[model samples]
Target chain A: MGTIENILIIGGGGMVGQKLAHALAREPLTPGTTSALTLMDLGFPPGSPAGARQITADVSDPAPLRAALAERPAVIFHFAAIVSGQAEADFDLGWAVNHMAFWHFLEAVRQEHLASGGSYCPRVVFTSSIAVFGGPYPEVIDDGFPPAPLTSYGAQKAACELMLADFSRKGFLDGIAIRLPTICVRPGKPNKAASGFFSGIIREPLNGQEAVLPVGTDVRHWHASPASAVGFLRHAARLDTAPLGQRRALNLPGVSCTVEEQIEALRAVAGNDVVALIKPQPDPVIESIVAGWPRNFAPERALALGFRADADFRAIIESYIREDLAPEQAQRLRLR
Target chain B: MGTIENILIIGGGGMVGQKLAHALAREPLTPGTTSALTLMDLGFPPGSPAGARQITADVSDPAPLRAALAERPAVIFHFAAIVSGQAEADFDLGWAVNHMAFWHFLEAVRQEHLASGGSYCPRVVFTSSIAVFGGPYPEVIDDGFPPAPLTSYGAQKAACELMLADFSRKGFLDGIAIRLPTICVRPGKPNKAASGFFSGIIREPLNGQEAVLPVGTDVRHWHASPASAVGFLRHAARLDTAPLGQRRALNLPGVSCTVEEQIEALRAVAGNDVVALIKPQPDPVIESIVAGWPRNFAPERALALGFRADADFRAIIESYIREDLAPEQAQRLRLR
Candidate 1:
């Protein structure tokens, strides 16, 4: 190995973080480089990927974050945040964890840079979200569209993006904020996120369970699979940020489709029996929340910068089935 | 008099704040309602407006802000911030005052709202600036343009706008962040702001003093007068925010003109001798900084909402002469 690259993943216990951790364990961040990984979060799932040191700590407190910065990791992936639902429900917690913690973390990074005579700038990849965009949107949200976030979660994310860009501009760190679309077919039980049903309708049925469709079938949204999310994160880590100029935040490419199209893709992959498991239950609360979401995007910048999305919505379903479905679930699909 | 409506102006010592205070002392926020004004800042300028109580306090500490919020002022004008040049020079102080202090203030407001059983939402009028915008802009930046700030000051303002909007959405406060264009023909000595020369080239020359022009006359910029800034603040305090919806921040209208046009306006009003004091001595530092600023804007929302601007560039200069020129300065202009 040419060199040992130390990588840190905050929120490493989260789904996307674990997937990224596993991918990094399987391959080096760069050719001829051996990577050392450290994962930090409030807690980790059972049997998280091996070969990475895990630290259970709350980011809301700056002590642990400052301690972690002492090691001066070569690459830092900051994915730690309260989910949209929790953030909306608990305003104080959302601002403290999602926004304040990030600010403290950035300030710590700046201290490290200054202590090292400005040579310790690390590559920081932050996971911003599509919640950053609100409604009255253009048919296709282009790269130039402003972030008018309607939710506290989105407002926090957008604030982080601004700070990250400023810190990067001041040469404190090399940073990129990728606004990930809703990760579809999330691998796990349903959570309380208002957008959770987008994944529930697809993931639950594939596991031979009933799922609730909260909004109308015509309700459209932007989505990417967990696998594509990993790809975007890795690509962001290695991206030459020179092309991004001062606009460090990006609207990443994603598959945009309606709930009906998502159901059709699910049916095409798993057959009519699995599709029958989905039941319509109109949820006005979720409907109003989802209405503020962006249904489509023209993420020209990310595409041109070589960030790829799923081939199609059908491909999204296949990726989930291949990667997240349990052996028993896979067997049932095969037998069908 | 009708019921006394308590109003608080942060940064009350500053030019625009004093202008606003003077205006408020002269007239009530709403007819048929008596207005009681309170001004808070680190220090006040000599001869501040009468009939308003003054408090000396540092916003960097949350105690003073909390104490202020305890009174539950009906209208709050948050205009306090570190100027761009100073903010760019001192990163820590910039984030501390411009961003973090505002965060704490908002939190305090939320606390007051909760304490009052959700009945104490104040009308918060924040003085955001065109500095929130950066270059690579459209020919005419519309209301929908994203805030991609190239400076730490701009980024800080943008972050504050996000917090203000989110808080307003949660009904903790009824806030409006008006992105004020660069205030021109400022009636005072020039400060360290990179955009200072935009005012200096006019203010100094009109006062029978030589002014250094750092950039080319061809460099265009968007501007409003100090009088208009006060107007924007008062209008924001009285306007119905329901029409603003979720996007509580607005790009207020302004006059767009180049330095040459500004000089010509001066020559038209006073003769060539007064305009002759503007010396063309290009400074690259200010030039580079000003280059990233927005040149023009199409603030349709603000215009539609009845937020007006100076009729033209000549009108901007004329307003300064009419409102801010000292008797001695007026005498020199009359003789010219």
Candidate 2:
């Protein structure tokens, strides 16, 4: 049964949204029926797939959300927000975009559902982050670890997760907030996120260019390919949330390894020459910010729910090289 | 230098709020300076003391909040919300009052602080509840227990607690959310709260009236006298919140006892005539609700921060008798 038809992806201008859009375009929500996608962001996503209508608007404003709710899209993919470093630097903007926008969006959904005689609740896929967890210890943070967000961004995400559970429990909406691991080898120009280096080191080197390595080689963190993140969202959408109990958010499964382990995996796949393209440059700001983040997770609940991740850093690198990089550019880095 | 002067108590018509209003009216927030009190509720509270100016309005509404904020009260006690049973029965009303209203109030506070040239954040003491914990078996819930509220009321309180922590961290307001225990031997009326029977069984029996005892006598739960609850709020308002990092809410100290234990205490104080007044009339609805509630708490953080509660069930009963009932009523209850 193809339950999903109409789709709405907030923050569609971003990397994960773009990739998710591609995946959904390749496979219809209900095998045979192509899902019409409404993609809303601060800027219209470049090269968005067919059947996707792009809307440019500030997500914090409830007006656009109200208009979108009028169409009654069956599913909503909410990935819109200010990243951690930016949120910490600029508090108000972060609250407006990350917290206030989502609150307003949910309120709009509730209003519409009420107006429809209580039958217009849409399934919402909220992309949370591992930044939502921070602490004094635990080498492997399990699914049950309490969320004690150290940053404003994490706090906002945690708050949103609570709302998702409450709203879903009330039958106002069907929703899941998935805490995504730090996306490794993110294919893009580096932005302002403190965890940006997690991708930049892999991405820049893979592109036959120099990449900075901040912090120590021993720093361990969780990672997943872009494809896996999208897969987690899709799987969560079709999930039987009845078993979720009071916690609506789940820490999605991911590959957990230190930077040294990541480098070795790169060497095995792309050879030592490609790995050597990385340069060492310590940056305190990035180190401190990333240090407070949760190192790894035991995502037991998510794995039980059929969520998956890349087998290893090698698999993650291969996927990025195959999917994100140009073949000619990838071949040059291999030193075969 | 005294930091507190003017005061505002939302939900002032409620028992705890009324008691709080009386306490503030009797003593100054800052010694030698009488702090003016503004009491807001759905209806004007009776006998709310001389300094309190009662405003009959919805506490969740932003208009009255804005009007109150203009005065820049040094301390604000937010004790407003739909009780558990009512919230469960009326979902929409609960969301409106519990969630939306608090959201708007926070926004209003943020706006006021912004408009004040970054100097108008007040000490906000929000009375949260133990309903925030719905466990799958942990003998004693601790300060670090993750909030997984089972009911709509609990969900609302937990969400608000997160917001309080976030807003406080952002320097928007100085806030602390204290999760109060079930107020036992409650004065006046029996409300719709599922845990009201914890009070009803104790109150009615002492008043020489028949009391219905729902659920088994073995069901252990946390309890506090009205005086202790007020003490917690006062201590929270006056305490330096700098020690409380990201987690702003604390479970206030309370006496943990079972219904059988409570009955024994009632007999010791008011004699067998009063103890015999409790008749077992089990209601599955109330039984199930109370069963899901947390049995006891390890309020390590609150106790360490100097928050106190009654030593035992006898102390709780004695405090209620001494503070709430008239002298004639107390004498009659002692005889009974």
- Interface RMSD of the predictions, in order shown? 0.6, 1.5
- Residue pairs with clashing backbones, model 1: none
Expressed as tens digits, the lDDT of each residue in A1-336 for candidate 1 is 378889999999999999999999888788788778899999999877677989899987778888888899989999999999999999999999999999999999999999999999999999999999998888998988889899999999999999999999999999999999999889997776899999999989999899999899999899999999999999999999999999999999999999999999988889999999999999999999999999999999999999999999999999998899999999999999
lDDT of 2: 0.85
Residue-level lDDT tens digits of model 2 in A239-330 = 88888876788998899889998888888877788789888899888888778888778888999989999998889988899889988887
lDDT tens string, model 2, B1-336? 444478988888889889888888888767777778898899864687885788888866678889988888888899889999999998778867887788778778888899999899999999899988777749998877777777888888877887787788889999999999998878988998888899999888877899999889999999999999988988998999988876788989999999999999989988888888899999999888887899888989999999999999999999988888778878886564
TM-score of 2: 0.92
Tell me each candidate's TM-score: 0.98, 0.92
Supply candidate 1's per-residue lDDT for A94.
Answer: 96
The native-contact fraction of candidate 1 is 0.98
For candidate 1, state the interface root-mean-square deviation in angstroms to 1 decimal. 0.6
What candidate 1 gets wrong by more than 4 Å, as runs, is none
The root-mean-square deviation over C-alpha atoms between each candidate and the true structure, in angstroms, is 1.2, 2.8
